[model samples]
Target: MKKIWAPWRMEYILHVDDSVKCIFCEKKQYVLKETQHAMVMLNLFPYNPGHLMVAPKRHVANLEDLTDEELKEIMALTQKSVKVLKEIANPDGFNIGINIGRVAGAGFEGHIHIHVVPRWNGDTNFMPIIGETKVIPEGIEKTFKKLKPYFE
Candidate 1:
């Protein structure tokens, strides 16, 4: 069994700052895609290199709260996100999902978001199973820069 050393997460885990800002509501410097109802942004703690999240603009705790327009926009943005990742990374596949509540593995259960993770061949390794860590090759800021222009 090999142990994956991810020292970078220590900063996020150790530093606890009290802010009322919701992860999805915070105005980001870089936005990958945005429609009237939804927007896409790079995931700060991603499961893969080209990981991104599609979220509704309005604050909603669950998918059921989204209107038909918001739902359609989010899905459309998700598809566009896939296209961008394909053009940029040419990933072998993708994993798109939404975790509803805390019990469903949502880090921010108060806001609804869909995760789009680009997966390459042999992307899955023992690190996740043994060390419970995900190894993402690129940083979120770098990925944000790479994807931001595509949205415009």
Candidate 2:
């Protein structure tokens, strides 16, 4: 049996009480870019190396709740996230999406956000299939540092 050490996941595991507060509403230390209406930040538990989330500053669960300005900024930031990931990670492709509710896989169900996941050729390996574990190749802090400068 091979062990994959992901120390950062411990923070998420210990602090995953949703009743504490909405994650998007909290002071995000890993924010890559922030505008008046929206911000882009690294996903604490990413699906891939450069996984990011774009969300409106205002807490709104539904898409209909977003103001036109907020919607625009969120989309713009999403595009910027893709560009930055392309330059830094050089991914073969991307998976950008929004999960509306718990059933749709929205971990933070009350706050609407867009997920921008960078995908590479051969990124899907046997570990996830057989071992039931996904491997993240880089540390979150390292990825954050690499991405922050581009957003600035």
What candidate 2 gets wrong by more than 4 Å, as runs, is 1-16
**RMSD in Å for candidate 1, one decimal?**
4.2
Compose the digit string of candidate 2's lDDT tens values, residues 1-152.
96534344445555568665788897586989999999999998897888999999999999999999999999999999998899989999998999897766677778899999999988877776677678899999999999999999
Candidate lDDT scores, in order, read: 0.80, 0.87
| Reference-based TM-score, model 2 | 0.88
Candidate 2 residue 92 Cα shift, in angstroms, is 0.6
Clash pairs, candidate 2, are none
